[model samples]
Target chain A: MLPLIHRFIDQAADQNPHHPAFIFQERSLSYGDLVLQANRLANVLIDLGVRPLDRVGIYLTKSMEIPVAIYGILKAGAAYVPIDPSAPLDRVDYMIRDCGITHLVSSPVRKRALHQLLERDTGLKAIVGVDRELLETDPLTCLSWEEVLQADSEDPPVKVTDQDLAYIMYTSGSTGHPKGMMHTHASGASYAHYSAMTYGVGPADRLGNHSHLHFDMSTFEFLTGPSRGATTIIIPNEAMLFPTRLADLVQNEKLTFWYSVPLALIQMLALEDIGNRDWSSLRWILFGGEPFPPKYLRLLMDMLPGARFSNVYGPAEVNQCTYFHVTRESVQGDQPVPLGRVWEGAESRILNGEGQPVRPGEPGELLIRSSTMMQGYWGKPDLTEKSIHIEEPLPGFTKRFYRTGDLVSIDEKGLLAFHGRKDRQVKIRGYRIELDELENIASAFDEVQEAAVVVAEQAGGDKELVAVLLLKEGRNLDSAEARKRFADHLSAYAVPKRIYFPATLPRTSSGKIDRRQLAQEYAETA
Target chain B: MEITKMPDKSQIESEIQTHFQGEGIELERDEDLFSSGQVDSMALMQAVAHLEATYGLKIPPGDLVPENFRTVEVMADYVIQRR
Candidate 1:
């Protein structure tokens, strides 16, 4: 019964009506104005047959429309499924179908791609774009975002309970096919409250939106910022790849808070003659999504001497349950930055392979229990039961906890430090990757008989993907041709950096490819 | 393109070598720096900063990919061309 996000919007509308909630490109929306627009859109959805518990997929980018769609969905008593506009068509299509989406809210420019996906999958019943042209275009019942907001904003708000489904997020699908992780109103609100309180986010703060809505980290910037009447600035997708441009945006926008992957900070620190910008306003810099290199900590502390840094750690299943405060003392120490203690209302444990609790300093699977934990994997009861569990054996605690596939260690001070993924999952630039997804696609290539893709840490600690294949005996495929084939199926990130046409890949007696041997062989050679 | 006296290729290569300290890249001017694992993205930035500070030229953002930073010779030529 928390109604966290909604309560903030309503409060802002009444208390800080003129304060900016979002500042995009050249436009800004006051708190009252944003809530009013969201209310209008909610009325539109209700008019279009949306009901309690129905799913509405946001097929948009990190634009102003995103928050509007989110609040509108909530106001209509429906759950939201946010699909990253930049995600591969297959990933988006898979998520929409998996969530049983009946409506999609996308941008006008993104309509063609959404149409292509909808053509193959009949689950998406309506595709609404974000403008007047989209509204005018009557091609098979399409409506623009403006058309939807044309409804009266004064309609009595629908009754929504805290126990109701608020959103269904797809895990980056690092282990396999993306599974929908369901959440309730209370769970989503818990994180929004915790993030704002921890960072002291308020109207004076301006948060950066570089992450896609699909990633759980976006929950902190996109939700908490706007909810507090603060300005949330969207970092252009292309600008993120170019450090200078990203720096310019941050400087021009005067961003006060930024949360992104460690890889991005590495890129920023690498820029040539990267002049110290007027970052005096930057109060906090949060990094997560994977283990950050010690080098990053050294560089950032040297560069931004004044800003406070914190390393956030958690899985998408339970968004941001722990944070390690990065003070001047921790920076001067020899140890790698710890992921730190559990956040409020969160508990964690390190368990051995047999599900027994491990001693301190020993690496084991990390388990977490929190209010923000996902309701369950949507439409998969067996999966829900397998992934989430009740206490079977523990000396002191008897409660349910979510079993994270990540390997971690608990320090003597009870701080949790992440080691690596226990499963075949790997994180590249904060994006969870399922190696099986790459292998399954690579196996589909015409000239490949068997493809085993292994990731290796090169010198100075850079992870590179190397594919070792046992091709058809007489067939020879050059690296260029093999890479081209891989590009056709997988995204640029999933493509292996180097392709090795080995005579035969080493296999264990159990008839499984020995990844350890491949890594060792490639580590020295790559 | 702004032109400055091209420093001895050997001197530029020496600077690149010193910056890469323990990194395993041959100190040849013509050898591919990126593909041979001699310089990674971070090392490339270090090299770029050195060239910018020493040679008085600003490297554009678009030209900062691995292809352009392939070799000491290529980087020197690019700096000369862009200057």
Candidate 2:
């Protein structure tokens, strides 16, 4: 059987050879052209001694090179590691060394960074930069993107078993190190196939590539788009943060499909001139990086009367496990929006803290079992075991299930509804937050004598972390000064929503600040 | 407090209603904005900015949270509440 991603690209090239497969800034690559380029890239990799199962890191931003690099890696029968360029420098070094990556195909800018980093750790085989001149001099030295594509071979990679790893993606590490989750060809294919069917992707669809490749939401855009012969348009970087640019692309390119976190959708809805933008071309909007506000759902429906909005539920470990179809009737009713039905080849259930299945309407942890389940964290076997567990006395218990950590419930209709996270890990604008990280920063503040961070529920059921601090004996700092200090050490989102100066922290008899009590106070005052 | 009708009150109420129409409960001019739990801090930002731009008014950055946007009525009052 053909590998899942290749099967789609091959079919698309054969059926619609002249159709535009990818549209970057001033360049448009047709299905046939993309195939040829990927084939040449595969030939270059083979000549450089890259073999089946060898991991190749693609370190770059969202660009034309990303798609070519993905296709080339798979074409060489090698799995790819999509390194986020914007991640902290230490993270980039850790992923390269941890994955045992041999070659990194990246842009010239990244090549420079790699050069500086690899000098400190020279075990890397090569730093392949995207320049024609760079590729000619050395099989072991840095090669350019053009040099790799100059080969004439049209042959595809040799077939491999379904269980062979396809890609390795790293997510936020709870244990002080980023964890790389490995996915096999078949499992990763499951995500591409299910997304195509679920989102109704086809030749006529124009899909927007919005999410960074590091994020799972971009999988469908980069993987399924080419396989389905749909046109995948990469939104320019500056356009990502602004809604006007997205509106322009949708109306200009006639983009029919969109996938991003709900926060992006809300930003689009808040546009004062949103009414002027013609988003009629958008047919499907699949969103879920975090729990979306139901209010944003209604605003979207009112704005785009024809778009089919869906709530996608899944963690990075399992690509996409469930979806809730957005309907007007559901919005009018009092019930919360469902995360929808389980996608193809997936099974899901809500389990209580004790691991037993919860009764319908009872909140519990959401668990997923599916073909798309990751192999495991790249190196941390202990964490892998804890996250992927087996239920005793159950057959196929060895088959792993991923714990999503999200508290949820199942309705009578079997639709999943999100409640909250069981841990202090809150999603701030789609980026995962470990409250402990904030606490670490708060404790580091020189002026702060003591601190506690708690998620407070605000109006419309949204949660925000507010930091309550007790100053040192004689020193007092205002909220502005404390926030500035937090910004220096953490990302802006990690900074608490509000900083409160309390005369004395409310503590339990044991002397631990009563965080629960603080939350109650915020709820009352908020 | 009862709100006096302002030129921007109708525009603010209309936008808030449209902004929050399908998400959940509808909004009235005198509804508790967000601090009192009528809307949310996250969703309220959208409503605040909508009113500011639609009417050419600016809500200070220091006054960003729900305390400032507690009600469509308070917001309407804020049109005059500003220093």
Each model's lDDT comes to: 0.74, 0.74
Q: Candidate 1: what lDDT?
A: 0.74
lDDT of 1 by residue, B1-83 (tens): 13256666666666665544322223467664422222333335556776777778787776765456666777766766776
Quality class of the docking in candidate 2, CAPRI style: incorrect
- Chain B TM-score in candidate 2, rounded to 2 decimals? 0.58
Candidate 2, B16: how far from true, in Å?
A: 36
lDDT of 2 at B38: 22
Candidate 2 lDDT: 0.74
lDDT of 2 by residue, A259-325 (tens): 8888777877776677888889999988887766677788888888888988888888898899888
DockQ of each: 0.03, 0.02
Any runs in candidate 2 off by more than 4 Å, and if so which?
A: A131-140, A156-159, A333-335, A391-399, A437-506, A509-513, A517-526, B1-83
Docking class of 1: incorrect
| Consecutive 10-residue window with the lowest summed lDDT within model 1 chain A | A131-140
